[model samples]
Target: MAKLVLTRLGGTLKGRALTPNPLPRILWRSLSTEGESQDPSIDPFLHSAPEGLAFGRLTGIGRNTLKTDVIHYLEGCKLSINDVKFDYNRAYTPVGVLLQFPSRSSFDLAVRQTIRKGRLYKLEKIDRSEWDLKTSYDGKAVLLQGVPRNALQEDVERFLSGCNFDPSSFQTFVRPGFPDPIRVAIIQFPTQVDAMNAFCVKNRSFCLNNPISMRVLQ
Candidate 1:
């Protein structure tokens, strides 16, 4: 985004200057917190999602934007929307949106229209190939690294439930990633004990398989 400053002198506009706007404090803090919050020993690329496209990423918009927000903005512009459909994707750097357009021609048309008419915030076509590198944890979710991008959602969940970690208590949200060699995931256990076992400890070593702190379980 650009910052515009209008100089007013003697009740008359003197000149106008435009410059790049600085990133907001809150957003910067969140990105910076990624490293601070995660375990330093866990490699950034270690548990990265290789298949990458778990969710589509869109640019030229705020990370927190919702589908209705875009629809309302477009409606204000009196734009036609009979041919387009979209959804909100996960938040990422710069900005991102999850969009599901019906056709390629419609997608391309949207690109041109948004660029030309969207004077405030431009909307980019939703793409499936782009993925997010910001993987997050709630401290105890079992982390599974080296996942294949082509793996099915069911398969991923099944793997987590069937792992060495006790599966009886495994009833939670299994989602994820980072940008390393392959895909990464978590087992979504309800308790630390359920995520731990003979595999988790040996000779006073903790290996819960998660890259995050797990509440300093290390």
Candidate 2:
């Protein structure tokens, strides 16, 4: 036998039916107002199914705060997510996430919004540059450090272009963290020879008003 319990809040269903096996305690907690908002606008659970999806990484988050912090942020944006996987084995700190968006537009919106949250948390693209060690570089990647937080894509491209690397073939990334002047960036070169050249000139600064250090990804 089972008992049906119904409750409504903010024009949404808030209660659940109880069965012999019962639902997980976590599902019930999600029904509560623990990390939810009374206002429907920012409520993560108030959205309709999204039409597309995108993926991003969230650092500085822990196992306990996964639902409350990361998922809550996504919900606040009105984007529906299907699943979230953590990269515990790859990253020692285990601060990674794969966000499934409803559509490309939804993903773009999430990326734009979460970039603002990067100051407080590590949020960035989970592309090959971040993961996929072998394919990420293809033995032609250079790691740059000490990049100014405000450095734009063009700024990095301009500097790398001056070094005779095809700016189109290269990709840059800045890990999310506090507003520090120095950050890490990875540049994937077109060929291993170019990577070796970039690596040969180590400890030299480029890409901003201040010089940044570069190293070949091993």
Among all candidates shown, the one with the greatest TM-score: 2
- List lDDT for all candidates, in order: 0.42, 0.58
> RMSDs, each prediction?
28.0, 24.1
Evaluate residue 73 in candidate 1 and report its C-alpha lDDT on the 0 to 100 scale: 48
Model 2 misplaced stretches (Cα beyond 4 Å): 1-136, 176-182
What's model 1's TM-score?
0.25
Question: Model 1 clash tally?
Answer: 7
Per-residue accuracy of model 1 over 1-218 as CA lDDT, tens digit each: 55667787999987665777676777433545544666644766755623221222345665434444655644433323322223223311224444445444545555665668655545553344432323322223444444455565565554444445444423323244444443444455555455554225321222243232221111
lDDT of 2: 0.58
* Candidate 1 runs further than 4 Å off: 1-57, 74-94, 122-218
lDDT of candidate 2 over 1-218, digit per residue (tens): 87889888889988777878865666333547676557665657666644544556666665434333556776645533234554543212344555545466766766676667665566665563443332323346676777777888788776665454666654445555456434666777777787777667645756567687775543
Rate residue 161 of model 1 by lDDT. Answer: 42
Candidate 2 TM-score, C-alpha based: 0.34
